[model samples]
Target chain A: MNFDFGFAIVAAVIVVSALFVVRAANLIHAVLWLGVTLLGTAALYAQLNAPFLAGVQVLTYVGGVVTLMIFGVMVTRRHDGIDVVAQTEGADRGFIFASALFVVLALVTWKSAPHVPNPAPVASSADIARALLGEYLIGFEVLSLLLLAAIVGAVVLVRRRDPEPAGEPSPAAAAVSEVNP
Target chain B: MNEFLQGGLYGGGIIVAIMSSLLFVLWTERKMAARMQSRIGPTFTDPLGFLQAPADVLKLLQKEDIIPEKADRALFNNAPLLGATVAIAGAAVVPFSATIVGADLEVGVLYLLAVGALGVLPVFAAGWGSNNKFALLGAMRAIAQSVSYEVPLVLAALVPVILAGSMKLSDIVAYQSSHHWLVVWPFFLGIPAFGLFMLAMLAESNRIPFDIPEAESELVAGITTEYTGMKFGLFYMAEYLHTVIASAVASALFLGGYDGPIAPGLWWMVLKTGLLVVAIYWLRWSLLRFRSDQLMALCWRWLVPSGVVLVVGAAVWVVFAG
Candidate 1:
């Protein structure tokens, strides 16, 4: 069997990193290692001649989404050392079985190396612009609507409500009373 | 096959260089932070502490690995892997140069955005798997910030794509080489979109002035507070790598990437990205972060509308200019 050394290394990294991601005890470390695995995938993309995809890999995935995940960690107020065990205990065995299935699939795919046609290079961003705006305009509009909803949802979710009256005047009112009195 | 592999060595070197550059930027950020606060920066490590980063990385690698007792063993391990892997994989599609691109796929931009979006999973996984309330809170906030800012970011970026008229970054660069850079275009919304894109990019990367996720004062490192040793280092690297990519993309989009009077195309691209990185880092320390509500308001009420107008304006320009 002809072994593609570079592919092997990337595959190994992906597997080991995925394992680490699933097994790590610290939640933050899992996130960080996941970032590593994503980076490796970006490398693979580069090998595939998709530099723009690679850039977006970092820009959107690592840059935007990952940072958001980190932000999520804060708002949730997660305890530093607290570890939450899996809610479903048997999930591990299922994951193992899935991994085996995935491995078999991957091997088959690699061996077949399906004859994909080389894509014709376009002139500029105009092509994508035309596509997104012309043919995909409805999708684009829907995405905009989704964004608007997200904005409204976030604002509504985070706004603080006035608490029920505590015994001796609320904090704001008490402060005002003290200042005026 | 051997020839293809041999050809890939150069590609690997480029990746290594890019990664090393990011590591250098991380060190610069720390030193810059210290300098901004009127503190003596790393001066003890190696010849003026230049080797401090390498030393720090080595130390992290050597540190003992710890697992939280209550953590979901699988997801905990998966989080960092997810984070770093997505970062590196996203880096692949960035066209550093015409000849030196990682990938040249047709849907390069879309693939990039999609793959990059995966970054959120690992982050959420970290908090959810750890069963840590603080981590969970941080992860949620990060998600909120990201999702909100992403719209404006994507919309702002679309201006350049509209102007250049392609999703492939190589095509964009080539267009820039042929025509005057998009910045030179006299559309009314040109500069505003650029500004919005840059600001959104900064927030997207979680740079200072937008680093609410890791607000030291409130969250005590937030999502990453529990992480240590190499685990922390990986997160750190991922962040820096994001910064690098963001800066590069911003430059590529607005600053007429690789188009210049003197230097070679690749060098010019690097220079532009480097300068933008410096600016981003400078702003991180110079400005205070906005409150979450204020930040969200800025994105939705102001940035999104402005970005939409800019995109529409670009479309108008395209119709007229053509």
Candidate 2:
């Protein structure tokens, strides 16, 4: 399949699902829509001849991130159907940020490389791996370090604040109980 | 037919074959589990209980379909179907033999991994949509277990991918057929990686010792507490189908799929998959369920670390030995 037609179809699916993601009233539905959006983006990556990115997109986003998001949503809230998801009007900000980030990424990838803005017709995972580790090793390592820092930060944020008095539940646990109850 | 239609037909064919095979597997599982406890299993339903699975399925079909008054209708009705769909979809990348197969994508191994891991979502949806406390609790445990186990599962599967130097299942099998099954070769790395993969596969499939998500004693029917009739049947069938396809994928990766002396390729593939399926059931019947905390501890404290080590070992073996 040539690029444009596949990209268009996949992009359309991604955009529609992403719209549902932002507009769904139920939190769970929103999360599921996000999964569809990610799966579509993975298809787009496949269409773009970046099969490695497509696999990682499906594996990491659909399998890992989406599951994590659902767990967090389920455990922390009464989100089955009783509570409608929150809404915000910062969608314009999101659009601006996404577009700006896209432009920056496009420039970084296109401007620095051999001036071929057109991606190759086919690139296997091994080719991508060699490039990432050979020419872009520093960038990959730094990104991993950044991910490590974020993970540590999350652990710290969720750590117990202090010891509770005997038989007294921690406030965080208490809040969870109240919400779930 | 167009490619889309052909793909659909192929996928539908695989699903039908797998689901029908589940009848045999279901009987085998019950009889095996019963025999392990020294009891007769399902013999009265038919001769040797061969017809029992189909009879039960028919009974389920005749029962009333139910959606709780408080439940989300769409998700409640569709989650089980989604579960079954994900289970069947993984079959697309499974190379059953040298010739007969599904789409042999370049990234077939990753395709299987992604699809296998996608099984967790339906449980979450079913649990939340049921609007029952038991169901919600089940979904919570499921997500936690699936997420934790999938890390090690993916890492361990990647060991074979590294050793074979490709993500394509066909290539991996070809590599194995030409050299050695991954379960035997590479001296130290292959066996351990295969073992770790099996453990994580059990958790991923929510088989015994890792089936806390559906622990019968505490959670009633767990995620399926609110499901009934054919909807529940779909979930039941999807689960067995998942294990069967998982065994197929495992054999394709580690057991020299479709490659053996004298026998036809399909027979070899089927034989290996059958043995693995029986092995999985054996473990289920032989062991007790694990505590929730113990499951988590097993994944994070041991399996994940071993998975990382195995991946590195495979890669290093490739670098020095390949």
* Model 2 per-residue lDDT tens digits across residues A22-139: 8887777889999999999888888777877888898899988898888677656655556545576788898899899999999898777786556766877788889999999999
User: What part of the reference interface contacts, as a 0 to 1 fraction, does candidate 2 reproduce?
Assistant: 0.58
Q: What i-RMS does each candidate reach, in Å?
A: 6.7, 1.0
lDDT of 1 by residue, B182-256 (tens): 677653556787788888867765667888877888877867877778888888888888778877777667777
Global Cα RMSD, each model: 7.8, 6.0
* Deviation from native of the Cα of residue B249 in model 2, angstroms: 1.0
lDDT of 2 by residue, B8-118 (tens): 888788767877778788888898888989989888777798988888888999999878999988889889989988888888888888876888889898888888778
Candidate 1 C-alpha error for residue A181, in Å: 22
C-alpha positional error of residue B101 in candidate 1 after TM-score superposition, expressed in Å: 0.8
Candidate 1, residue A147: lDDT: 94
Give me the candidate number with maximum TM-score: 2
Worst 10 residues of 2 chain B by lDDT: B255-264
CAPRI band for model 1: incorrect
Query: What lDDT does each candidate get?
Result: 0.74, 0.86
